[model samples]
Target: MFAGCIDIGGTFTDLILYERGKGLEIMKSPTTPGEFERGFMDVLALAAKSRGLSLGDFLVKLELLVHGTTVSTNALVEGKVAAAGLLCNAGHPDILTLREAPRKRAFLTKIDYPEPYIPRKFTCEVRGRIDAMGNEIEPLVEADVVAAAKHLKTCNVAAVAVSLLWSIVNPKHELRVREILQEELPGIPVTLSHELNPVPREYRRTISTAINASLYPIVGAYVSKLDQALRAAGYKNELLIANCVGGMMPPDEIIARPIYSVMSGPTLAPIAAMQLTTDPNVIVVDMGGTTFDVSALRDRQLVITPEATFGMDMLGIPKIDVRSVGAGGGSIAWVDAGGLIKVGPQSAAAKPGPACYGKGGTEATVTDANVVLGIIDPDYFLGGQMKLDRAKAETAVERFAKKVRLGTVEAAYAIYTTSNHNMIGAVEDITVNEGIDPRDSYLVSGGGATACHIGEMAQILGIKRFMIPRFAAGLSAYGGLISDVRWEEAATLHETHVDFAVERTNALIDRLRARGRAFLDRAGFPRARQRFEYAYQGRYLYQSWDIEVPFTLPGDRLTEADVPRLAAAFHQMHERIYTIKDENDVVEFTTWKVRAVGDTGGADRRGVDLPKQQGAPSPKSRRKVYLGPKQGFLEIPVYQGDGLGSGARIDGPAIIEEPTTTILLLRGQSAVTDAHRNYLVELAG
Candidate 1:
């Protein structure tokens, strides 16, 4: 049987078809913003046609159809979410506006502070009170709830969110309010914090509920349209969507809880990098049109962080620890008033695209720089399917040069160098700043723009080894195809180390695992293929911050012997994260968690070996290139990437050109292709 996976990104929509016991087929098409489903279906049709099969014939043998999309993230960035109304306890209608003090920064002078998603006019209050100890100080009056519902109906909001204080301890008030809203406003969506995120922080819970309500209408409509299109195309297999936690979930679940997918598009590529190679510790860098995402992996497992901030909320959700920066191929380039060159936090987007694409884009971009520097061949880009205009690129770059008092080629090359430095700095922020040594990690680079700068980044980070997969451009879609079904379950426990009981801790673990298992089982995973993990939120007795420590349970229970071992593990983790451990202080467990995963075994594709080469060919051509203070452009050799073979060595200055990407080897560097056809570049002293 065959399985299909699709990833819709900001610039391109990628598709992959995996046939068991055979191999994989891939295709790519520009993403259509007006109709994303149209682009998705078009790629599927192209993949079928490439294999000489009909859509119906291919669907008959398909076992699964997995997908990853950026709809939720884009909606939030563009301020295009649904009109939402918020219902809160009386006298606390302004809780969202009274955000914590730590969020405001005084140095930012470019833009004003962002406003809350829910406007003041839409915020309604009801008379109800709950104490921190889960005691009801005042009963939830039915009349108050009815009046709020009537007010929301008159506003004609697309969705409603209800957040009550201490809902995690006792959800009685939130539950009662949801029932009344549903009864009064039939067919309108209602979200409750108790159902979405049952936690202690009032502001965080309120923000998460409001975000869910804001995204409900948009995400629901997108998923519904895609589902109908897939069904009409004769696809009768299970549909799974990639979530921000680097796992797959049923489409129905994603439609109801889209808050889990805010970072879905970037998480998949890292998982694919881990699956493609045998490296235990590595950094995965995925650079797309609008941004670059860098994530670190240790022992082939994605780093999970519980304190991820999403859309103005400190959501305590388990997500892959990814750091994203506003730097990419299509990022705009310009000179500030101080004569300093700047690359973007803004993009030309796919509508006009980069100036080199000759699509009416007036702003200069990194892609245009590569074209002006002779690093990219205008006629050979995308196999000549899309032609670039080198003259237009030079003209755009010269405009910036006149303002900065540098040559056109020099200014363009500076933009390229600065952008690479920015990306390298992002990697350091996540690793070196966090006390991890960069030399110990291998670099995995993917996406259309990453291959262009990987060799330079590797040199700067002092890492010698790098790997680029066979279908590096479509790794995210491939990741969606191979992801396992998973979910996270968590609960808060207020017990201190001195008062903690071994039996109570074990019971909480058991309850969480049972809940996770039931969720996976309902998704069609059998008991034999299921796996469970146990973890705890630990901290010093008086400390406010907590760290997550993972351990395997002994037959669904924690024995007395497990306490000391767990404490030691927590100390080691604390030392790694904070660079110190306070063994004299009492350690306490604040929250318990369980993550259940189901394996979907599939055969791995064998990699193709590179051809043997006796000697490197002479330079096909020479072009002027800049290398830091080496002043004027230096002569560089150019070679086609497909012609290089195993053991083929090339010395800098050189450029490797491929149909989809280009690689530039700077001065004082050497490159060699490995058995799997991946380039490993080393900088010479």
Candidate 2:
């Protein structure tokens, strides 16, 4: 069976078709942001036409279809979400307004917090109450639900969010309110807190559910349109979507928990990085059109985080624990009012890409700097598919130089260096600052722009080995094909150390497992094919931050001894994370977590090896390329990446050109093709 994967980035939407025996074929199209489905269908049509097959014919042979999108992230960033109304408990109507007291640091003189997603007028209260013990203290009034629904209809809200107190313990009141609203308002979509996130910490859970509700209708409509268009075009494969947790899930499940895809765009590269390297430890540096994401991978797994803040709330979505910085190939470069040059927090998006792209963008960007400094060949970019206007780039760089009070080349170098520093800082934050030793790990660099800056970044971070995959530009789309179908279930049960009972914990785990199994069964996987992992949020008595400890439980049943064993796992994890642990202190289990994964097959299979290189290498041609400060405009050898074979060695400084990407090797480094034909770049110690 064939599989198709697509990833929509800020600049381009990529499509890859993989046949069981024929390997992979790829296509690229500019993303149409006005209507993303247009771009998506356009690329799918192109892929079908390339193989002389109809969409329906292709789908009949297709086993799966996976996609990664940046829509949710962009909507949140640009404030393009649907109008939403919030329904809170009777006494907590002003929860959104109060927020947290320490919105900004106390010492900051000027700090402006962004506005909340929902306005005061749209936030209404309902007469409902639930005690901390999960018992109903007050009944939900039907009149209140009808009134809230009518008020929301008058406000022209596209969706409604119902977040009542203690909904996690008992969703009875919330369910009744939802039923009343549906009967009253027939068409408006509603998001209940219990359905989205049945976790404690009332404020966080409430805000997260509200945000999900706000985006649900908009995202759901978009997905439906895209799916229908593809189906009409003759595609019938299961349309898989990428999640923020670095896994792929069916579109139905994704629609149910849209919060898991808020950072979908950035999570793909780390998974791709892991696939490209054999090293157990490495730092993944993914530099795309708009941002650079640096993350640490240990034992080939991307670090995961349970808490991440988006817009105005702490979303408890399981996500790749990546650290992001605003440095990219398209980052704008300009001089500020103080005569200091700065790289971006602002980007020139795809509409008017970079200044060198000759689209209407006049602002000098990192791409323009690279063009002016001779780091990039003007006529050879994108395999010459898109010719860059070198003169336009030079003019822009000269103008920026005049404004910044520096020479043309000097200004370009400064911008380049500063951008490198910014990325290096991100790497350090994930490594050195977090107590991870840089020497023990290799650096896996991908994304379209990473090849341009990998050498400098590796040098700054003192990392020795670097691996650049065959299709770095399309790595995320590649990752889509290789990830598993996974989901996480969590619950909060406050049990103090003195009162903790093993029986209670086992019962909670049993319930979660059943819930997980039900979800998997709906997705077409049986109980025998599923895998389970367990963890808990525990802390010392009276401690503020809790540590998440993972453990494996017996398949059929669990006993009392599992509690202390689980506690022991927590202590070990605490020591590993913080470098210290107090074994004498009592541990309190606050929350339990279980992750269920249905494997798609592992990636441990070997790759086809390339033939050994012959005696003498034929020089294609020599081009004047810039290496560094001392060696400016040196004539370097360029080789076609596809022509290189296994055991072939190319000494730097050189450039390896491919249809989709370019790899640059600096002086004092050498590139060797491994058994799999993947380039492994090693530097002198």
TM-score for each prediction?
0.92, 0.94
**Candidate 2: where is the Cα deviation over 4 Å?**
52-60, 100-107, 496-500, 526-528, 602-608, 615-619
**Which pairs, if any, clash in model 1?**
none
Which candidate tops TM-score? 2
Q: Candidate 2 local accuracy as lDDT? A: 0.77
User: Please, what is the whole-model Cα lDDT of each candidate in the order they appear?
Assistant: 0.79, 0.77
Q: What's the true lDDT of residue 118 in model 1?
A: 84
Q: List candidate 1 stretches off by more than 4 Å.
A: 103-106, 109-113, 277-280, 310-316, 602-639, 642-651
Per-residue lDDT of candidate 2, residues 1-685 (tens digit): 6777788866677776677655666677777877888888777777777778876676677677888877777787787888989998888887765655433445876656645557878988889788988898888887888898889989999888888988888889989988888898788888888777776666666777777887887778878887888777667667878888777778888777677778775787787777777788888777777788787777665677666666455664557887777788888887788888888868876779888889888888888888887777778776676788988888888888999788888788888888889888888878887788876898877677778788777777777788877667777777777777778788878775556776777788888878878777877776676887777788888886676766688764556656677668778878867888888788888888777777765352223556787764555777877665787678889888777777778888888776666777888778787765567888844
Superposition error at 128 for model 1 (Å): 2.9
Candidate 1 lDDT tens digits, 1-685: 7787888876778777787655676677778886898888888887777768897777767788888888988887777889999999989988777655334346756655557668878898888788888899999887988988888888889999999888877889999898898899988899998778765667767877888888888888998999898889898878888888888888888888888877887788888887767788888888877788888887676787766665444544557888888788888887778877888878876768888878798788888887887777888776566788998899888887888888898888887887888789889978997899888988888777787777778887888777765466677777777778878777777665556688877777788889999989988899998988777888888786778788778778877877777788888879978999987778888778888887765325434566786687556677766655555567788877767778888877788766566677766777778775566666655
Cα RMSD to native, each candidate? 2.7, 2.4
